[model samples]
Target: MLNLFKKKEKFILPVSGDCIPMEKVNDPVFSQKMMGDGFAIIPSDKTIYSPFSGEVSVLFPTKHAIGIKSDAGVEVLIHVGIDTVSLKGEGFESFVQQGDKIAQGDKLIDVDFDLIKQKGFDPVVVIIFTNNSIKIEEKLHHGEHHEKLSISIK
Candidate 1:
């Protein structure tokens, strides 16, 4: 079948932390995989990087989430924290603008997790497929950085 030749896209942990299954996320929208199947990270640092080469399709006005369309046409949404959007951009700084071309590891945003916590929010970074239906073929090792989380279309 033509599907046999489909190229797999590999993404890395966009933040430094333990990679966890989407089901482990504290949010229903993500834990239930309502937004789409992917992974989550309990980030230990403030910086978030691009998971793959792509064009930033949407950067929420609150600077809490960003969506990127990969070169292979995969749309990824990276949400910074749980309920942090209610902060209205406080404690969040975006490095790239919408429509900007980004490479893997490029800094996307800097967040003040302490502020998020002080504001009573969970600073869990959530990544999900926004436009296409794809399956995570492989997950990175726990605590691994700069390693790929391979994915393929169904």
Candidate 2:
């Protein structure tokens, strides 16, 4: 099949916002577990944007998570925080619904960072590939409070 010759694809951050590395969670003081694949440290409270160009594949009923399918066939899952999905959409708003076409930096979800923290949850956004078998190259920018994170294929 022609599929065999297709080049490996890459996915980049959907938005221009803060990013944190997951390795920092090893400290007990943070008391957080890396639930998924990628790590991001968000320093401010604002809108969460789409990291890649794709259709809104899945929007959690709780409004705490979103899934997007990139044009290159990469599925991206962005969870706002650990267990924040349990909030059931409280203090959260969904800007895009399933089947909606979206491009990088498009507003997808607006989360109440204060309310998230008030609820005793950390607002570390996580971007992960739902299909792990796909080859990916992750690019992480170091330092605290950084904007403009990048990712690509191998």
Candidate 3:
């Protein structure tokens, strides 16, 4: 019966990138985990994918960020880069429309790191679990992109 009450499941990385601890993020809002408890990705690839199977909740007009509402009821926010909204949609592309159902790893957007760098923006993607009561199954990330990111929801 205790096993039935256990929280256990995994959430995969949306894109291939270096996973950085939320503390390493330069922004206080993210570094402090104000958004939610999750890590950031210093992208090794320019493409952004859905981290969870969900409907696209928010896709910024500037293409710098996206919010997803998982079928499981978890809300995920993927913010691409720091202070990048100022770029004004210069180096990003969106593949899915708002309300589109997405499976894990589905391509959502593409980014031009070269352009972002030239314009002085750090393209570190922040993945935040928006709900306040979220409890993670695993608490350690060492910058490795796994086939699946094991996480459990309580």
Candidate 4:
């Protein structure tokens, strides 16, 4: 019952990649609305790697979303694109399954940008924490498409 009073913890990025911010959250429409919570956007034609070291908490059957738990007890959720979940695994592929252990840089999923575009969805990737009580520290914006971005515990 005391869990409600637990102090929020901040989580750092698990991988070093470009961070893209979604226009909105929990909205099925692809309209570029304002984003509520900040999200890290990773843009790459290659494989999407695990940002933090943790066990896979959830893997959407559509291969559009994944959830991971960090060793530090932080929970993270990654969604590939807007409204892409409805594709039902068309242009997306999962390399790991639920309950799998993953480390930073570990390959998690492979996304086909071309196919995703063909399906009429933008391949804007988002990395977010499922738990939001934690405070973030030293968050840095290393510029779009920059490969040197780093995230650290606050």
Candidate 5:
């Protein structure tokens, strides 16, 4: 009966990388969860995937970031590095457009790591739920790609 009442949904990691606690990100905005509660990844691959099945809500003009609205009503923002917007999308390639339907694990973007570093940027992909009305369960101190984390609606 208790399980039947559980409102939590599993959100997967969009990249194939080592998940780190948000504080490790070095940016106050992300480490502070000011954008929303979520995790950061020290990505091993150049690609980015969708963490949930949802609609692509926003794709920044610079192509350095993207946002999605999950079918379950969660709003997610995936920002691809610290201050990387200054690069003006130089090393990034977005695979999806705004208003497109996406599924978890769908490839969303591809990044040029060397260019980012050559340009002196720390490429830390952050996954944040912009709306705080929901509760994010687990510290998510670390995890593997596509690992499940629960989010409960309040």
Candidate 6:
């Protein structure tokens, strides 16, 4: 009966761009949902925002990816560009450190997609739920606004 009280959370798009099905991504790891089922956005802007209020769980030294764990125990991985690790922090600047508390819309990282592209990488911002158990209650592609996706943690 207590299930009714479960906190409902909404995820805003980390960047402003096109939302495509995970299957459509070029990388197999993300396309197969190997890390976890989530979504991807081809960012038109350089700044990446926090999708939800959470603690920064893991921030890669290379600054290619970040993991944020929501209070509800949802772990979200935000990876910028495919095969970006090889860049070794180049063209990427992180605004938040690991373990930092972040709110929705907080600036997390600034990525230079042009540099990534020049380095022969696809700058597709991939957001994945590392924890497979969390169910994505809904995916609302509200055109060009703060509200884009929603996830309910049970």
TM-score against native, each model: 0.86, 0.73, 0.85, 0.71, 0.84, 0.85
Off by over 4 Å in 3: 1-10, 135-147
- Arrange candidates, best lDDT first: 1, 6, 5, 3, 2, 4
For model 6, residues 1-154, the per-residue Cα lDDT tens digits are 0021255555677788877667778999999998887777778899998877889999999999999987667678999999999999999999999999999889999999999999899998888878744444444252333334445444
**Model 4 stretches with alpha carbons more than 4 Å out:** 1-17, 22-36, 134-143, 148-154
What RMSD, rounded to one decimal, does every model reach?
4.0, 5.7, 3.9, 6.3, 3.7, 4.2
Error of 5 at 122 (Å): 0.7
Candidate 1 lDDT for residue 55: 95
For all candidates, the clash counts are 0, 6, 2, 8, 0, 0
lDDT of each: 0.81, 0.64, 0.78, 0.62, 0.79, 0.80
For 8-121, candidate 2 gives per-residue lDDT tens digits of: 443445444566555554333232432344555564656787766789999999988898887877676787776787788887888889999988678888888789889888
Q: Taking the tens digit of each residue's C-alpha lDDT, what string does model 5 give over 1-154?
A: 0010143445667776777777778899889878877778888899998877889999999999999997777788999988999999899998899999998889999999888988889988988878744455556555555355555655
lDDT of 4 by residue, 1-154 (tens): 0021232322334344565444433353322323223455556554777765779999999988888887777676777877887788988878899999877678898888778888888666776645643232324343455443333323
- The 10-residue segment of model 1 with minimum total lDDT is 1-10
Ranking by TM-score: 1, 3, 6, 5, 2, 4
Candidate 3 per-residue lDDT, tens place, 9-127, comes to 23568777777778889899999888787778888899988866779999989999999987767788999999999989889999988889999779999999889988888879888
Tally clashes: model 3.
2
Inter-residue clash pairs, candidate 1: none
* Span of ten consecutive residues with least summed lDDT in model 3: 1-10
Pairs clashing in candidate 4? 8-133, 8-134, 9-134, 14-51, 14-52, 15-51, 19-41, 20-41
Clashing pairs in 5: none
Error of 5 at 41 (Å): 0.7
lDDT of 4: 0.62
